[model samples]
Target: MGNIIQLSKSSPTSEWIDMSNQGTDCFLELLIMAANDLEKTNHQEKLISFLKDQKDINDIAPGTAGFKLDEMPWCDETLIDDASFLICVTKEAQSESVLSKLPYKVNTEIVFPWLKQFAVLIELMITASER
Candidate 1:
């Protein structure tokens, strides 16, 4: 569907993650860590399946964008002005100018409670990568 986004890592680490015990506390911690780690690499391929490639960010407002990894939620990165998804990245991580060009908006109200599940899923992903 158009509401899909896929991201692929060139050199995915060999790590496996577990989600059986994923909850509020565990998910956020791991997610922040994983995000930090992913920022280290260059060329983070972001594919917006819901919108055409090279389309204007305004073209896809309020749409769910899927990730290559199904375990992760369909991140809604639409922004009223511009995408701020890269704001979550740390200074230590790689600085990709492309991220700044992407339209992103943070949904704290919607995303706050889901941090736990996010962390748990990351654990499973990392664990699976390790295997």
Candidate 2:
């Protein structure tokens, strides 16, 4: 198994405060980099393929499934562009249903795919999270 690195050390509270500030700065920088890349390559087919592969890994299909989030989780790390959109599968068919509320311009609907074997739906969830 891989080892995990703890971000905090058992140190003085002042040191921890400094570390927290540094960590937040680092996170913001990473988020900015990710946003730049997302915008630069938003229309690239490769990125779409990458997203599709991730969706498959998460067992996300084109139609409704058990994994659709009732409340859409916003992805704070990603910045959406014109091509940036959300993909989800839902069987619910009410006006107030989760799927129906998604913005029409950026959301796509399809049947959910069955997973071969895995409890991890992080791929799709992360994609949704990114949106």
Best by lDDT: 1
Top TM-score: which candidate number? 1
Q: List, residue by residue over 1-131, the lDDT tens digit for candidate 2.
A: 11111112332233211212222222222222233333344343343344334334334332221122212233345524312332211112111343233344211221112110111232434444456
How large is the C-alpha RMSD of every model relative to the true structure?
13.5, 17.6
TM-score of 1: 0.29
Tell me each candidate's TM-score: 0.29, 0.19
As a whole number from 0 to 100, the lDDT of residue 49 in candidate 2 is: 46
| Candidate 1 per-residue C-alpha lDDT over 1-131 given as tens digits, one digit per residue, 9 for 90 to 100 | 23222223432332222222222112223233335444322222241221222123323432332233443233333321111232233221222342232245333344333443333433444455546
Candidate 2, residue 3: how far the Cα is off, in Å: 27
At residue 14, candidate 1 shows an lDDT of 29
